[model samples]
Target: MSTSRAPPVFLLVLLPFFASTAFISSVNGAAHMTPETSAICPTCPYFLPTPREVTTPEGIPANLTCGVRLLADRKVSWIRRKDLHVLTTGDFTYTTANKFRALHLPGSPYWSLQVEKPTVDDSGIYECQVSTQPKIFRRFTLNVVVPSAAITGTREMFMKAGSDINITCIVKGAIRGAPVTWYHVLPRPPYTEEEVEEINAGGRGGVQVVTDKHAGTSWLLVTHATWRDAGNYTCAPVHATPATVSVHVLDEEVPAGLHHDLHPSEGRSSITSPPCSTLLTVLLLVLQRVAAVNEHGHWCSFCLLLGITSCLSLTAVYTAAGETWTAAQDLSSTWSVWRL
Candidate 1:
């Protein structure tokens, strides 16, 4: 009995395999029953609920971040809500655009989508999705701003001498009242080095800047403008593109199609030629001189010389007054009078 009958050969052969199977089953059951083991087991992937919001200026890089907890072996992806296009997944970019890329560090729970040189068109909502049985997601907002600075009026300005130069600079998409700096670039010789001077408010006589912080506008005023003030004026604002305007200061006459306000001090002096009546009077005087020459033949040479001299003087006056056609007409009439 103690020795028992010799165990069957098949039972002896299968005993080790049965013991191993029972041992494995018991270990697995114990693992499930242990609280510490259950607590340490991997959990389902879920979003950490840390919402991200980003705003970046145009041409700058924008980062949209997403935080996830317990994201074990799950793929994270970024999708643009505007077009529903998949942007990035697990550090790999799906779009053909090179500006977009996914950023993730080793052993980090945060995933970020970076957009280089972002523009205003890139602003919109983005979704960060995690691969799970039901699929979890977190939404984020990205706003791209395009800051700009420009002068209010035309690029080229014609200002008269002794008139005031008033220029306005407006800033858009700025976070707050942007500080503006004015620069003056004087006209220089072709081969000479350019000279740029920084303009300060209240630093010189009749030159000052008025800023409206609330309106994000700055006004540059140069009282009693002269020929020396004619050049290029630039308005540079912080975090915005600079704008320039060319200024031309005329001596007395304003060109045609120019604004009357250019010469505020001298009220609208746009005339370039004398009146028709004055020209007619000059013509009659020349004719009268010719008649005198014809009447007195004794003083022929002296009277003819006087008539020629009077006609030539009138022609010179017409030419100097910017009336070239009138000058030519007067010369023709005088020749006719002399021939008569």
Candidate 2:
């Protein structure tokens, strides 16, 4: 009777064991036999595979791609680092907030956010996030470079002493209202180079700065060129690279020492010789001496000999003067022309 009363008490213990065995068997079967079964699939964490850093020019469209592997139904997003503003989510872009759109090719596991008319303000860190049990994220840095400041003139400029010099600096793709400054830069003297002092926008001594704010342009003007003005001039913008130009001031005549050193093939001679008038004056003097000799044709032999010697000396001087005149003209022609 006792055995009958406790009959099948073991059945209750065996029932749970059988059930667990069946469940584990099903799991093993699905894992090994039914490879395409989703219920038994092992989970793999989502990941982003794109460049961590990107650069683009201003005023152009920029696209930041976020590619994922095994991300199955997880959401993708882009956020601004500065403000934490969400830019895109799962192929949807917050267009009203930013000129951006999320793009996903059909049946593809990758997506991208495109920004239109990117500016300096748009440069910074951005985050791409995946919505999961434990959220996964990636950070991307975007750098925007504005076009460098450019001085609208020849790199090498020449100006005569007492002449006015004007140079313009133009900037493109810079932030609005960014100030541009003109600086005078001089290379350090001789062997041990030193840092040269920079003279700022208001003009140093005889230099003057005129800025057109709306046009993004600045002018560096020298009222009267002098030896002091011959150096390096730079147009530097607050947001861009500096543009440099060289200034060379020429005197009315080339110095004798410089003239002797210059080769005929050299680009420019440091010294400038006098203009055409000197040659003309020499010719006139020679003609006057000949006229005196002709007016007194019956003069004494001694007087004649002195006159002949004077004429020969004048002719020699004239020949030497001609050579100097030609060299001066060649040097003058090679001087870089300064423009307004």
Candidate 3:
């Protein structure tokens, strides 16, 4: 049994070195993967650290923020996706439009592109780009929603004269307690700008503007509705789309055609009369029949009276003779002759 040989020296020496090297490489790789280590790296600037969507109201400024890390020699800019228009570049500079500016907040590592007084025209996709070696970018969508004022009542309202008119104006996507103004626009189309201007300044006669504001809504009360008040009323708020409603005042005197009982399907009402000659003939026939029946009854009664009186006198004589007599035949014959 013999002597066991030792392992090879080269293999024994290389195995430990390889194991140590693998352990060191794994540690270094893990460190590089960490967020803190990634932030310290100068070349990689994280563009966005928040949500990629932004919504703003019309006529208000919108600020889209971008995260910049160690961007000393790098250039940051905003580009519109629809037109590829460069809006802002670097810090405190605008590249395309006058209303856009790129500014850095004090003591912060963030850059913002300010869109002043943005409107629906400004709604689109935007990109924040970093001028790195490989060109890094982040996308954002901007939606400019216009706050609107809507009248909740029917578009055309029916009201009798001398009645109260109340209209509700609901504000959607507006700040709470926003003021809504009511205007009485002319009923006819093609209203002049001068007339609108005058109404905006102060209403004319028969036009009263009363507004009460509540949670995201406004109530307009017009007292004593009249013919002159029949027109288009608009609920308008500052820098928002206005809503319109039509007021129709009913006349005091109803139409002659509609004076009768109203039929659901028919617009007007009417009464039908039977033929005059037909009704008169029916009435005359009924009267003649009643007179004939009365005359026949009188004749029958006279016959009965004669038969009874004569029978009673004859019955006294028959009783004296002790004779039984029945007057059935005599009474029947007498009545029949009198009827003829």
Candidate 4:
């Protein structure tokens, strides 16, 4: 009889346990074989595309960002292209400048170089470099600006009454299409507060404002300017410093640098006419002396001729005073009498 040997009792007892454990192992291995459960292999460091152009105003902080992928065990550095100076390396700054700092978080792919209080000199190309077998870098352009506002002409302007008032303001290094507003501050009494108003186009007053965004210029025009328009005019830009110009309106022509104060209580302005009044007084005293010398009636024609010539000369001087002299009409009447 060819009978097979019987298995051991211990082997038979452990066989089922071994079979269950092998079955469990196979199932777990198959689960891990799936795409979602597989391990990811390390990749070469590379830069991810982000905005490479940055613009910030002076005295403001600027951030230059660099997005990286699979940067395991490699270092990232920031270098200024202008001077070839290394600024930061892997969350640490290499330069001694306090303005430069490296910003990065643990396990984060984004690395940034922070510039505190950036100035115009800091505006240039910067490079974000990665350490690999062959070094790779991405270039970023930084533009720092200083915004300012200024008027094109003199700080103080004089305009005659009934004339047009023209004021131009220019804004530099400001954001494009930034609106510029015009403001007028009326002259006030010595102890009183000033009154301010906004100027607009087609307003109730004859004031008009024209702005050219592309040219970065704003113009204020007031047709038939009057004393009421005399005050401080300000050009305020949304992104720049405000600029001011003083406007002085006169009823007649006046020399530059000459100013007049308005008296609201009197309802009119006053000006001193010393040149014309003093000349007239002196001429009268001289004519009286001439008349006394010719009282005997001798050389009467000569005295009359001398007086007439003197009056004519005085009239010429009075006319040269322009419209500033309020007594011009009175002086003309006196000259007519002397001629008669």
Candidate 5:
């Protein structure tokens, strides 16, 4: 006999132990929202619309922007959490540094920090705070990357009092903000980097304040370089680490170097020559050989002259003799070369 029985509730207590369990959810349990749930798009867990990523400024007068979704009300007070620096409180804006200015856009929820051509000392952190449900505060790590003083273009010199030589100091990119100061070392380099650097790069060497593409690039076009322009040149690619380049001008530094003399390892990418000398020499030799052959073949010239004279004489005789022969033909029988 089989007995059907429902298990006791106490006995079913073991059921939980036998069943599989899910993982423990973290504090942020709201997972990503799929597009299928279009209505919840705005309130999606991962729907934080962060501001665009901005690179470190290489110069002064930088713009830092913060995004706010109609939430950062007048109660907006900026408090930097990283360093615990209270930036703004109530309607009062406080900044010890005179260069910082906060600008609130009209009709837009974007506030920006306009840093007045800041310097290496002005680099720091900035926080954008908005009084919202979660008190939305964006922390932006601000850094002013002073560009490395790398070579931009060089000033190479070769002059015959009025010959041109190009020395290009090729640097990476124009660094906005700081002005590039060009300095030159007189006499020669002192076998040291510190010796090459000048106290005021902008003072000497015909101050070329690069107003154009200052951060990444700049060029000095020197026409007809002379003996006075040869020295160790400097390119302050970054104001902090002003780079230096040396240009030596030679009176004989022109484009009049031999093609074959170019070192194979020179890495110069060019191949060109007029080939006038070689072509002229070959033509002269051919003309001379032709003239020599003509001199050696005097008999050929004489033969050609004789043939022409003989042809003329034969033609003359044919015209004159033909008439007489025609008449004589009646008297006698005759055949001539011209008639044949």
Candidate 6:
């Protein structure tokens, strides 16, 4: 049976391998291995190869291309994580970014996503959706975390004293709602030490938040950003395992303490109280340089940084309603974009 594939459709189909625990797959003797691991199919698993983080070799542009050449009888589609907007399907394309385009290797069994000059706005969980009688699917997280002098969370500013300094937590993996709290690492008299609690003219709860998902890009929104709001903010999700980003909002915009720390574009690092993915995983992969692995036998840093990471070599497992695959991970490094 010649298992090849037609042009791929964007369906936000995620390969369950990466989102879950690390699963090891031994690579066979093949030259064009999309990733370190190949599909365990006698025929073809036309999923794409995705890397957590790739230090583009200088001139090398950023793109997420599935390094496979397979024939899949199923159809594919891509949806926006925010509004569930279908970007591409079969021969149709709908994104405004000209840098974005799909392809099919003639005589080859592979499909890929090509982003021209990927920007921060281009980070999110992209589902490689496949549809069939009883479909088989996979996932890839295209982490377009371009280097920034000030790499903060999604960034949202609000009123301060008059409003609740809402600090939200960014989630990773599958954590829906964990724990959302605020920390004053700066100078605080302690929760009780404050003899005078300034009453905000808002509502009963000074600050309240609304979480969406754990994959889309999000950051805390301080109702009123001010010198008093300057401090460390964190949101811990139900996953509990550790996946949060400490957003340091300064009164005068101080440099992030952990200047060298890398933040994930999607849930690759932190989870929100809930809500956020589809293209490109719609997330970013934070590469932590930990000294050693932990007792759980998992990488220590994944848990330490309040961010948990599971290593997988692209094990295709689609769990969504309508999704499929081609060799892909997530994060567009090979994709090309000229930027506006």
Model number with the top lDDT: 4
Which model is ahead, 1 or 5, in terms of lDDT? 1
Poorly placed runs, candidate 3 (over 4 Å)? 1-44, 47-51, 57-59, 69-73, 92-94, 117-119, 132-135, 145-148, 161-164, 171-178, 185-216, 221-230, 251-340
- Model 1 is weakest, by summed lDDT over 10 consecutive residues, at 23-32
lDDT of 5 by residue, 95-189 (tens): 68666667775666556766676665656666665543334455665566655655544434334555543434445423455455566555432
* Clash statistics: count for each candidate: 0, 4, 0, 0, 23, 94
Task: Tell me how candidate 3 scores on lDDT.
Answer: 0.63
Q: What TM-scores do the predictions have?
A: 0.49, 0.37, 0.47, 0.51, 0.42, 0.28
Comparison by TM-score, 3 against 4, better one: 4
What is candidate 1's lDDT per residue for 1-340, written digit by digit as tens?
3776898999889765543332123222111113332243335444444546887778877788887766779899999989999999998999999999999998998999999998889999998887754465777888888777889989999987899999999988664666888999875544557688998864568999888867879899999987667779998877778899999888755443332334444442453554433444455566567767676654655654665566567667756655554556655665565465
Off by over 4 Å in 4: 1-42, 105-107, 151-170, 175-183, 188-226, 248-340
Q: What is the per-residue lDDT of model 2 for residues 1-340, given as tens digits with 9 covering 90 to 100?
A: 3554664878777655543332233222111112332233334334445677777667667788877666677787888879988888987877485668888997787778787778889899887776753455667788777768888859988788899889989977566577887766543334434344555544466667777777879887787776556668888877577898988777644444333222222434444544433443344455546756776544443453454445545545544644344433422332222110
Q: What CA root-mean-square deviation does each model show from the true structure?
A: 15.9, 20.2, 23.7, 17.8, 24.5, 33.6
- Candidate 5, superposed: residue stretches over 4 Å from native: 1-59, 72-74, 89-91, 121-124, 152-164, 170-215, 219-229, 232-242, 250-340
The residue-level lDDT of candidate 6 at 97 comes to: 60
lDDT of 2 at 185: 55
Write the number of the candidate with greater lDDT, choosing between 2 and 4: 4
Q: Is candidate 4 or candidate 5 better by TM-score?
A: 4
> How would the candidate models be sorted by TM-score, starting from the highest?
4, 1, 3, 5, 2, 6
TM-score-wise, the better of 4 and 6 is 4
**TM-score, cand. 6 vs. native:** 0.28
- Model 1 misplacement above 4 A: 1-45, 49-51, 150-170, 174-181, 187-195, 200-232, 244-340
Identify the superior model by lDDT, candidate 3 or candidate 6.
3
